[model samples]
Target: MDKYRDRSNTLAKERLTRETDKQASQNMAQWLEEFEATKDRVSEIKRVKSRDEDRYYELLDELEITPEYDRYEIIKGYKRDVDALTKEWLKATTPAQRDSCVQAIIGLKSDMVRELMNTQQ
Candidate 1:
């Protein structure tokens, strides 16, 4: 009877190990799927960003403004900074954070306007 009990215990242990391995394998597969999906999403976003950048340059050319122009380039830098700040503001969950973003954006816009005025004069 003792020998039979020992055999049963060994079989139970083996079964438990198999179940744990199965669960681990399933979890790894799910993680891989999620990783692949994320990779695809990043690739799509990069493509869209590339297109937007190309369009921006095209618009600049259409307007006859070369990037070599110092004043316009400075304004462009400010615009980029403001755009980033706007995105940050949109993502901010707290009012204080949003306010900070707004202030930064306002400052950038003010600087840009000042630069524009100087260029005009």
Candidate 2:
């Protein structure tokens, strides 16, 4: 009777484990589908943004407009974001906080064009 009871308990434990795994698998599958869809949309947006930025710069070149820069030759603009992110990065004390600051900086850099500066001082 003891051996039979132990066997039944084992079987019940396996059944519960399988059920939990099945639910987790279902959730993961749904999340994967959403992730792929979002990834594709992001790629599309990047392509369009690239095309538009190129067109805008080309027009500026054709119109004989020269873009000016500051002391370091970096473009000057009203960047509330740079201030916010600088504060966040300075105040970040955890790995997760630092990682978020890194991500934000990378995202901000993506939209900027690298400017060539004259070094014939």
Candidate 3:
């Protein structure tokens, strides 16, 4: 009777493992299907982002914005600091980092130059 019970337990364990693995496989398949379905939307968003970036860059090019023209040493220092921050922002993945960097470089809700030279010690 004990030997029979042990065999039954082993079979039960094997069956449970198989069922868990099967469920996991099904979940992965569903996830892949969902990802495939969103491909078009993802592509559209990426294209829009590319266009927007290109336009922003073109504006910068037309404006010829640079730090080299600033005559004051303090303003040049601010430009350098802002430039470094903007470079970090270009590589940032999170929205918060991007927003903060942009705000630091460009004044909030205004195209006018911000006073950052005084902040630097």
Report every candidate's CA lDDT: 0.55, 0.46, 0.45
Best by lDDT: 1
Write down the TM-score for model 1. Answer: 0.42
- Which should have the higher TM-score, number 2 or number 3? 2
lDDT for each residue of candidate 3 in 9-46, tens digit (9 for 90 to 100): 56744553344324434342343344344444344545
Q: Which regions of candidate 3 deviate over 4 angstroms?
A: 1-70, 107-121
Q: What is the lDDT of residue 66 in candidate 2?
A: 29
Superposed model 1: Cα runs more than 4 Å off: 1-71
lDDT of 1: 0.55
Tens digits of lDDT, candidate 2, 1-121: 9899778756754553344324434342343344455445445545665669776555545433322222122322313564466567656789899678656654543332222123112
